[model samples]
Structure formats: structure tokens, C-alpha cells
Target: MNTKQMIKENNRLQDAMKPDNLSYYQDMVVYIRSSSVEESKGEELLLEIAQHLLDAQAKGKTAEEVFGSDPESYCKELVEQLPKMKGLNRLQYHLMIPWIALTWFFFVQALVGFITTWTGGPVERMTQVRISTLVLIAGGSYVLIHALMRWMKNDTFQPDEARRKINVRSMGIYMAITVLILIAGVWLGRLLPVLTIAPWVSLVLFLVGIAGTKFLFSSK
Candidate 1:
């Protein structure tokens, strides 16, 4: 199928599935990509898995039965079976790691800062930290947005203008969210007290949150 056709089919499949099932499939796709599978192959794998789910549902089976009780393990097995790509695809796959990490790092810091603010942490110290954190957040946001655009442009699976536009729009939404969070953090830092926890403890908490969120979203 052509790129537009493929995207249409993908959208149809996603719309047909239950929300939880769609989320499961989306998570699986993310996991597969993060596992170093090439983008085209990842999309092919997702389409195959999505079809299986639809067929199972038609047979009156739950998504759990279709995907198995342990979706994470199933996805890992799929990743293991994928043939490694060479050349630019391989390079792009490796590059995605640090890009994703930087994005997650900023996201975690923003979330943690918001938590600290809501808890009545001291405003003075937080305001001081916010300066540096904001700078890093802006840089991280730019890196993430740029990486996403580059990925979309280079993706072999969705080379059509339609798919590229869709992907860019999604990235724009994510950027908007990042901007809002940064703004909120700045305002909150000015209003709240400094956190009672030590810097190390807070750092630990941020790491934990980043790890958990990454696992859930990327599963890598």
C-alpha cells in the first residue's frame, strides 16, 4: 500500500479498537521502536499485531488473549525476532536513545518541580534552581522537537506529505505541552517554598519518575 493508504488503514485500526487496546498497541509500537527496530519494520509489526487483535476480537476474544497475558514480554520477543537494519536506519535507531533520554529528563524535572511547589516547598531555593532548570528544559525541548521532526522526515514507513504533516502536528502538541509546563514551573517557583527534601533525595525521586514513565511509554 502507499503511504497515505497505510496511514488511513492505521487510523482505521486505531479507531476500531477499544481505548485500552489501542493504548496497548501504541505502547507496543513504542517499545518495538525503542528496541532498535527500524521504523518501517516497526510499523509493519504494529499493523500485523493490530490485525491479530482485530481478528481475535471478531472471534470474541479479549485483547489480553490476543496479545497474551504479558504484553511486555510479547513485545520483547517480537523485538528479538526483528532482523537488524544497517546504514542510516541503524544510525537513526541509535540516535533516538539520547534524544528520548533528554526529553524524559526534562519532563521528570518539570513534574518534580511542580510537585515540590504544590507541597509548599521554599520559594527562594526553588527560584534559584528554576533558572538553571529552565535553561536545560528549553534546550531539551528544542532537541526533542528537532529530533522528532528529523525522525519523521527520515522515516521510511511514512514518507508521504500527509503522514509527515500528521507527525509534525503531534510534535507541535507535545511542544505546546512542554512550553506550558515550563511556564507553570516558573510561576510556581516564584510562589512556593523550597522543598524539605535534600537535593540528592529530590534527584533520586526525579530519576525514579523518569524511569517509570519511560518504561510505561517506551518500555525500553
Candidate 2:
């Protein structure tokens, strides 16, 4: 559900509470009803939203009515005439895109590292740094994207997109792809005459690097 929907639903729930507490619910609903927008948001937009919600409760219809037959019209008027909806906020398409991209970027690079090392090329110490940086980026992306998804899509933490809502065959395919990558890496590593690093050692480093990066950049 969208923010507006959430606010509407929350409004309905809040109406059941004590009258003294209704002000807060209506205030929140006002902002969700807003269509004004903020190019950049700050306390100004927040306060404006707050005031509108309060007004809706004070002189406007109850929050439960946002879903009423007149709600569409009401919301339309609220958005258009309400003037101070939100400050200049631009519409964001999806927060998932960047996070998905970042995670895959690191996963691909890890493969590249394995391939290079397997081909008897020397892997640099900085390889971990590169991996770590990518992981950090992915972790941060995951946090924000997860937050956006939680607030808008569902209200809880979720794993990566692939990890969620997958069919058994799809899950199997994911595992197969992972195994293939590991096998290829191992094959390349074994092909080396002296193996600058052991295969298990490299794997351990990869795991440790990812874990450390996550811990360092953790948002939760």
C-alpha cells in the first residue's frame, strides 16, 4: 500500500481510540492526503502536514471516511486546495532498483575475483577493499530500500528480493548458479601452479569481508 493508503487505514484505526487522541491520527492523515509535494522536505513540510491532519480532525470529516464514496473527491480537494501538501517532493519510482543493482554489482565482482585468481593471476590485497566497498554500498542500499519497501509495500524487514517470494525451482536455480560460480572459482584456483592463496582461504575471506562490511555499515 502507498503512504496515503497507510495513513487512511491508520486513520480508521485511530478513530476507535479515545477522542482526546484523535488529533494525532487526523494530523497524520492530513499529510498522507497531501499532494502538494516538497522539492526538498524539512520540518516545514512536516509541520504543514501535521496541521492539515489536525484540521481534518477538528473541522473536517473523521479519518474513517477517507474510504467513503466522497473520499476520492475529498482527497482530491484536499490535495489540490490544501496548498501546503508537502514541500517540493518529487515522485520516486522504486527504492528497490538501486539496492538490487548494488548487491548484484558486488556479487559479479566476487565472481571476477575468483576467475582472475583461478587463471593464475595474482589477486591484490585491495581486492578485499573493493569487495568490502561494494558490500558496504549494498548494505546501505538494502537498509534504505528495505525501509521504503517496508513502509510502502509491507511493514517489516525482508531479505533480498530473490530470497523473498520464490518458487522452489527458482530457489534451486539460485543455488545452482551460486554453486557454479564457486565451482568455476575452485577450478581456476586449482589450475594455478602454486596457488597464491588456498581456495578455502579465499572463500573464508569473502565471507569475513561481507560480514565485516555489513557490521560496519549496519543501519539497524
Candidate 3:
């Protein structure tokens, strides 16, 4: 079937299934997409999987029975079997890391500044040396994270359609979370003078928390 027909059929299947079965189907698609190396291939796989699930449901079978007990392993095997695409150069990937890190660093800094101002704390201007150090550390962190993902073979396929979905509500939620984190960081910094003494300490902790969470979730 064509893409539009596939999507419509998928939606129909989702509506027909019980909530629990629908959840299982969604989770399977998420797993398959995560394992896939190419966006187009991932979408195709999702549609195919959805169709299979629909057929199984029509026969009064559960998703588990249709796939297997270990759906994640099956998805991983499927990913391994997919033909490799001519991906970006390894050097290019490495080079983009620092830029991504730098963007995140500035975003956090801006959030912190706004939080401190709102909390009636004196916003301290960072010294050039301190800023430079933070930039270096952020760059280093990006390299370390990339290396760790590669070592674990958990590097995500780029251009994910699900990730590319632009939801204004999601963006608002993220902004709210950022504000909350900044406020919490400022409060914590006040309680522990070390974080205040070294402003980047909180940033580092935040980054570490994110990396740790990603690792834990992706492992499953």
C-alpha cells in the first residue's frame, strides 16, 4: 500500500484494538524505529509491522503471539539485516558534536541567568576565562558521550520521523522543564556553595544526568 493508505490503515488498526494491545503495538514500533539505521526504512518497517499486528488482531491474536516473547531482539536482528546506507563521514559526525554541545551550553546558561534574576539572586557575569573553560568542557563532554554511545553500539539513527515531529505543546513542556531545572539549580547552588563557586558545576551535573538517563533508557 501507499504511504497515505498505510497510515490510514495503521490508524484504523489502532482504533480497533484494545488500549493494552494498542500500547504494545506502539511500543513495538518505537523499538523498531530506534534500532533502524535509515528513516525511510524505519517507516517502511513500522508500516509492515503495523499491518502484521492488524492481521494478527483480526485472527484474535495478541501482539506478543504475532511477534514473539522477545520483540526487542527481533527488532535488533531486523536492523542488522537492513542494507547499510552511505552515512556521513565519521569525521563530520565528530566535528558536529562540539557545535551541538556549545548550543546546549549556551541554552543552559541563559536559563540559569533567567532563573537567578527571577529568584532575586545577583546574576554574576562570567569571566572570559571561565566561559572559555566551560566551552572546552562542553566540547570534551560531547566527544566523551559520542565515544560512549559508539562503544555501546547505542548511537541513534539520524533523521528520525518521530523525533522530527514539531509539536508546539511539546516545546512548551520542554521550556517549562528547562525553567524548572534552572530554578532548582539556582536553589541548590545557594544551598551548596561549591555550585555557586563553580557555576559550571551545575551544568556538568545536568549534562551527566542527561547522559546517564539516555544510557539507561536506550539500554532497554
Candidate 4:
């Protein structure tokens, strides 16, 4: 089955688990899914584990009895054994978020420029390319992805109430950090050299972003 189907099956199976076993099994689910293993393999393993746990439960066994007490260590071992994503696939995965974000950003800029030019706004001969803004976005996205992975790893061990609190706190911190990065990027952009971009350049950039996204994500 595909990743989505496996996940759906796992979810359906988990509904029958005893409370303690469900909690234990969910910890494994979170940790395994958070790892860098290929999605299909990860979900397949999760579904298989869910099936095994259900069978064990039917035999009057606990999840701890079946998989041992240390879910984290067991999950880590399983993740290590799973095949990692291929190089191109990994690249596409990492770039997907930032690529979509930047594309939409440039698209808005292009659309505004097109509208302004048609509406008799001043057409400038040059436009500023904020290198630092681009840098901040790319760097920030990488940091956020790693942060989320770490959060998932740690949060899996926490009680539900505590995990909810942590989620709220983490989101606040992330938003604060994003604001600071934007401020810093604006400052740094002023210190960098400006690029010469015509009034119509944003439109070109929008088209390029579309083409580049297709090329990068296209199947081999």
C-alpha cells in the first residue's frame, strides 16, 4: 500500500488498542514518522507494527511486552534500518516548502507590478534584490524543519496536556524568531549592493519560478 493508505489503516487499527497500548504505540508512530526514512517505508512499518500490537493485545499482551519498554530506542533502531530517500528525492523534499513560498511571494510582486504598470504608476528602471531576505528565508526554513523534527522527537514522550502546552510555546517562539529574522534581513539588505531589475522583471521571475519548480519536482 501507499503511504496514505498505510497511515489510514494504522489509524483505523489504533482505535481498537487499549489506552496504555495506544499511548505506547503512538509514541513509536510519532518518532518513526519524524525520522528521515522514506515515507512509504515508514508508514508501511507503522501499519505492520499496529497490526502486530493488535494481535498481541488479543493474546493479552501489552505493547511494552511486545516491543519492550523503550519506545524511543526501538524506534531509532527501526529508522536506522529503513532505506533513506534518494538524493534527488531528498532535495525535492527539502526544497518544496521554500520553493512554494518564494514562488507565491514573487508571483504577488509580479501581479502588483503588472497592475501598477497598467494603472499608470511610475515604472522604475531598477528594483532591489534583497539577497539577505532570500538568505534569511532559506536559512530560516532549514532551521524550522530541524526544530520541528527535534520537537516531534521530544514531544512524543510527553503527556498530552504537556505536549499541547509545548506546542503553543514553540509556535510563539517560532513567530518571534520569524519577525526578528525579517527585521535583520531588511537591515542587511541595505548594506548589500542593489541589482538592476526592470519594471517587467518580476513577471519574468514568476515564470521562471513556475518552470523551475516543475523541473525540480518532475519524476525521473
Model 1 spans > 4 angstroms off: 2-5, 92-220
| Candidate 2 per-residue C-alpha lDDT over 6-66 given as tens digits, one digit per residue, 9 for 90 to 100 | 4454555555544743543443344333333331232233334444455566665554443
After superposition, which runs of candidate 3 have C-alpha atoms over 4 Å from their true positions? 1-16, 89-101, 108-124, 127-220
Q: Give TM per candidate.
A: 0.43, 0.27, 0.44, 0.67
Give the whole-model CA lDDT for all candidates, comma-separated: 0.62, 0.45, 0.56, 0.80
lDDT of 4 by residue, 174-215 (tens): 888788877878888878766655546777777888898888
The better-scoring model by TM-score among 2 and 3 is: 3
Question: What is candidate 3's TM-score against the reference?
Answer: 0.44
Count of steric clashes across candidates, in order: 6, 13, 0, 0
Q: Tens-digit lDDT track for model 1 on 50-154?
A: 898888777877777787777767877888888776786565545554445554555555566666678988634543344434444555555565556555433
Model 1 TM-score on a 0 to 1 scale = 0.43
Estimate the overall C-alpha local distance difference test score of candidate 1. Answer: 0.62
Question: Measured by C-alpha RMSD in angstroms, how accurate is candidate 3?
Answer: 13.5
- Which regions of candidate 2 deviate over 4 angstroms? 1-46, 59-61, 65-128, 132-136, 139-147, 150-220
**Top candidate when judged by lDDT against the true structure:** 4
Among residues 3 or more apart in sequence or in different chains, the pairs in candidate 1 whose N, CA or C atoms overlap within 3 Å are 121-193, 121-194, 122-193, 122-194, 123-193, 123-194
Candidates 2 and 4 compared: the better one by lDDT is 4
Q: After superposition, how far is residue 193 of candidate 3 from its true place, in Å?
A: 23
